[model samples]
Every structure is written in C-alpha cells, then in structure tokens.
Target chain A: MPVNHSRQKRGIAISPKNNSPVSLFFEGAKDTFPLIVGAIPFGIIFGTLAATAGLSFGATMGMSLFVFAGASQFVCVSLVTAGVAWPMIVLTTFVVNLRHMLYGATMVFFYKNLNPLWKMVLAFGLTDETFAVAVSRYSKNDGVPGKHYYNLGSMVFMYGNWNLCTFIGLTAGKAFPGISQWGLDFAMPATFIGIVIPYLVSKPMWASVITAGTVSILAGGLPHKLGLMMAALAGVAAGVICEKVFSEKKERI
Target chain B: MFETGIQLYEIYMVAGMALVTFGIRYIMFPLSGRLRFPELFERGLRYVPPVVLTAIIVPSVLMPTGETLNLKLNNPYLIGAITACAVGGLFKNLLLTIVVSMAVFLGAQWAFAMGW
Candidate 1:
C-alpha cells in the first residue's frame, strides 16, 4: 500500500507535512501532555485500589497492561474484590469497553488510507485520549504526513505514563493511602469538557451531548458501567435522528 | 482486612477480560475495511466523539461513584466542573481547564471542610 506521500509537497509549513517522523512524534507527545497529566492520578488510584484490594503486584500490573481501559480496569478490580465470578467480571468489562467500537469506526475514515499494519497498531493505541487528539488533528487536516507517527507518539506516552503510575501506586499506595480521595478524578471530566465543548458547532452535535449527558446520569445505577454503553448508543441515535430531521426541514424550506 | 493470594481463577479472569477488551478494540478496524457503511451511518459516526465523551464525562462528574448523585453547592466536583467548562469554553485550553478545575476542586474541598 503506497502511503499518501502525494499529499506531501503541498509545501504547507504550518502542518505536519513539513515535519520529520521524530519531530511529529514529539509534537504528538507535546499535544497530549495536558491530557496525560489528568490521567496521572487516575492511574495511581488504580494502583492503590488494586493493592488495597489485595491483588498481587503482577496481577494488578497485568490487568493494566492487558485490559488497558481505565474504567473497566477499575470495575474489574472492584468486582474481583467483591468476589464476583470471573466470567461475570469479564463479561461486564467487555460491555463497558464496547464504546471503543465507535472510536474505532469513527477513526477508520482517516485510517482507511493506511496499511493494515498501521491500522492494527493504531487500533491498539486508540484510547479516549489518543482518539480525542488524533481525531481533532485529522479533522483539521486529513492529509498531514506522518500523522500516524503523531498518533504513535500520543499512544507511547500515555502507555508509559499509565504503566509507570500503576507501578508507583502499587509501591507507594501504602505510603499515601489517601491519594485516591484527593478529588483528582475531576481532571478527566474536565479534559473531556475541553475536548468536546469546542466541537459543538451544530444542532446534531449539541443534541448528542444533551442526550448522552442526560442518559448517562439516569442510567448510572446500571451494573458494571452499562450506563456508559447505553448513553453512548442513545446519543448516537439522537444525533442521527436530529441530523435527518434538520436536513429534511432545511430541504423543505 | 483483605485476603491476599494469586488464585488460579483470578488469572483466568485477567486473561478473559484482556481478550474481550482487545477484541472489541481490534474488531472494528478490520470490519470497517471489510464492510460498507450506509451514508447516514457514516455521517452518524461523526457525532461519536461528542456523544461518547459526554456520556463518559457526565456520569463521572455528576455521580462520581455511581451512587453519590451529588448536585449541591458542596459537591466540589460539580462546582469545579462547571467552572472548568466555562474556562474551557472561554479559553479553549486543555491545560488551563485542568489547572483551573483542579484548583477549584481542591479549593472547594478545603473551603467546605472548614464549614463555610
């Protein structure tokens, strides 16, 4: 598969086109730094909770490495501590992560031009943070060269930071047992606000946000974060319906 | 207060969760290549970012533990989040939003702890 090298030589110096792979990678890292800061406490809290839940260091780290979804990992640890059956734990986590399907599908538009190998790698690294950064970048200019390198950069930094914090929490969790209670989790919601608020320039977009936010709270009592899945589905359905209705209204007028 | 052991069943659980999580993340990319989406479906995918993100953010802020359901003035997360959203809208800076939100969160927590 020939890379989209033709998109290069447009000679736009402001875009990723003029940058080297190494420079693009670092640029991605730099762009993602603020989000990573928000993730720091969440990662450490996972470590602390895992340790407090009596999970062995290897098991805790293994969960972080293998599952790699923050909310699901937290749910898995809680369920494991609660003595829930392993199958139930697995099933619940699976349901919680179903949102990744949307992330993957949405990302596929920009990624369609890349080879399968690049797709596979980016797929692994497609967490919410990376998706937010990369999607915004692609939305701005889909033709930027080495954009995949930028994605790789964000992924590597987040991956390392998560694992490192888990280690820190596993070891230092005992020393600072109250760390998780320090209200740091707010950073994540705040980051999402920054990411999503800027993009609500249309009715369908605003409808999606209103629908998803309302449904998420109403469904919060659902087990294993099923509320998240329900809210996401509802929001997408609302957005599509709103888009259709609005377009039809415009056409008729 | 908690039992400490690496039981065989726990290992199985870890592997099972990992496989399923990875499967969900991995399955979509290939399927998108193989299958064709309808025109509306493609358009709907554009809203995925806002919708999914709002879903994640709302519950975390409003009901931090999925149980608290805090909406009062003393709920530092909610107050700080409102402030953060305003700052984010006004400034359009992630670092500033986080910094302001965290500062508001910590400050609110301290203020409430002091009974005012």
Candidate 2:
C-alpha cells in the first residue's frame, strides 16, 4: 500500500541509536532558551500594555494562556482598548496569525507519519519560535526518531516562559511603567534575524527575504496585518519564480 | 477598581480570540499530511519560514508604532536590528546577537536622549 511504502521509507531513515527522547527534549529546550529570553519582554509588554489598556488581570493572562501568539495578543489588546467589536478583534487576530498556516504546511511533510495524538499536541504547541527551530531540525533529518519530542520541549518551555512573564508583568508593571519602552523588545527582531540569516544561502532565498521584508515595511499601514500575509505570499511567489528561472538558466548553460 | 464598560465583554472576546488562534494552528497538519502538493508548491513551502518571519520582523523594527517608517538616526530599533542582523550573519549565535543588540539599542537610546 502507499501508506506502508511511505512509512517504510521514513522508518528506515531514522537513526534509531540517536532516538533519545528525553535528551532531545532537553536539547530542544536548551536551544529554545535564547528565543525565550527574547519572548520574555514580549510577553511582559503584552501584559503591561493590556493592563493599561483596561484589560483585567484575568483577561490579560487568559489571553496569553489561551491565544499564546504574541503579535495577535498585542493587536487584540489595542483593538479592545479602541472599543472595536468582538468579531473584528477575532478577525484581526486570525488574519495576523495566518502565517502559522504556512508554518503548518511546511512542517506537515515531516509530521505526517506521526499518530493523531502527537500531531494534535505538536500542532497546539507550534509557534513561530518553535517552528523555526523544529523545521530546521526536521529539514536536517528526515527521519530522526522521536523528533517530535524536541518540538514538544521547545513548545512547553515557551508556553511556560510566556505565562510566567505575563504574570510578572501584570503584577509588577506599575512599579516599572517604562519597562516596555526599555528596548528589550529588540530581542525579537534580533532573534528573527538570527533565525533568517542562516537560511540565506541561495538566490531564491535571498530574493524572498529581501522582497518580503520590503513589502512588509511598505505595506505596514494595512488594516488588520493584511500586509504581513500579503508579503508572505509575494515572497513565496517571488522565490518560486526565481528558482524556476535560475534553474532553467543553469540547465541551459 | 476602575469600571470599564467592556469588562464583561472582554471574557467573550478572549474566548473568541483563543478559539480562532488555536483553530488556525490546528487546521493544517492533518489535511496537508494526507494530501499531495504539486512539486513546485512543495518546494516553495521550504522558503516559508524565512520569508514569513522577515515579513513579520521587518515591520516591527522599521515601523515600531505601525504608523510611520522611522529610518531616522534617532530610531534605536532600526539601529539595533541592523546590529543584530550583522552579528547574526557574522557569528550565527542567537544569544550573543540578542545580548549585543539589546546593549546597542539601550546605548543608542541613551545617547539619543543625551542629544548625541
């Protein structure tokens, strides 16, 4: 059967000796720690800003625990403060998070062999930070046995960091009202730069990054983060076209 | 105990945001795993992380307030991002990049405040 063929191919590729789930999990956690450092200020800013925006402690923390996405949470808080209606808030958050769909698509190739429960758990835990690290690992090893545990480690650690920081910010934000403006937020873009720079090894890749970043800045004023979604699509399209053209030229030569 | 008129409604909004956020995250894996994407489409997905991430990161720096592009010398964020990108490209170390970037950002902000 096609399922068996797929399973056998992936199963054979796994380095069984390297299947140390616990160590892999901790390694994932360790690797993700630096990213967590960046996220601390992000979560704190969200909590503090949400409180000042008139959200109750319970509501602010609830959003962090439940929504878990940083950008959307910030957007939700601002829109809520502006007295935007609930549907609009929901729609805006959803649009802002559509990039996750692309992440899921990229990961599904490696995740397909997993059982439903594992799929559900990892899917729930997936974030931009975890996905960036996890996808790199999966891309490196098509069949690293117990690879999902690494992603689990990253996700669980990030989830914990986000929640704890939110609590700290909510309770202590008044004492340090200027904490958000302390420029700790620089960690995020820096973290992202570190993540993206490693992938810039090809013409199509460089083209995609430059185009996406430029489009995002130019379209920054778009309503509800549609610019981000638009830039992602444009970048992907540009990458695909560039890949085809460049490959054809190389072949002709 | 300030009484905001929307306190009661915030709960529902929070729930709605949670549902939509989780729903988006949960929607794709199962379907994509079972289906077959065309060769070109599959190849393109490999570029998704860098492209989408840069798309998110760039605006956060250049347009921190989301209203205007601040390419000015006083913009610590732009300076910090450039510093971080250079460090990341040169060293490929996440922690050092963050640490140095924040240091530079704080230093630049301080200098700007001092009218330098």
**Whole-model lDDT for model 1 versus the true structure?**
0.84
Worst 10 residues of 2 chain A by lDDT: A10-19
Query: Judged by DockQ cut-offs, is candidate 1 incorrect, acceptable, medium or high?
Result: medium
Q: Which portions of model 2 miss their true places by more than 4 Å? A: A1-18, B1-7
Q: CAPRI verdict on model 2? A: medium
For each candidate, the alpha-carbon lDDT, in order, equals 0.84, 0.85
Candidate number achieving the greatest lDDT relative to the actual structure: 2
Model 2 pairs whose backbones collide: none
lDDT of 2 by residue, A142-218 (tens): 54577888899999999999999888878888788888777677777878887898899999999988999999988
- Compared with the real two-chain complex, what DockQ does model 2 have? 0.63
Give every collision pair in model 1: none
**lDDT, residue B23, candidate 1:** 83
**Residue A128 of candidate 2: its Cα lDDT?**
93
Q: How far is A141's C-alpha from truth in model 1 (Å)?
A: 2.7
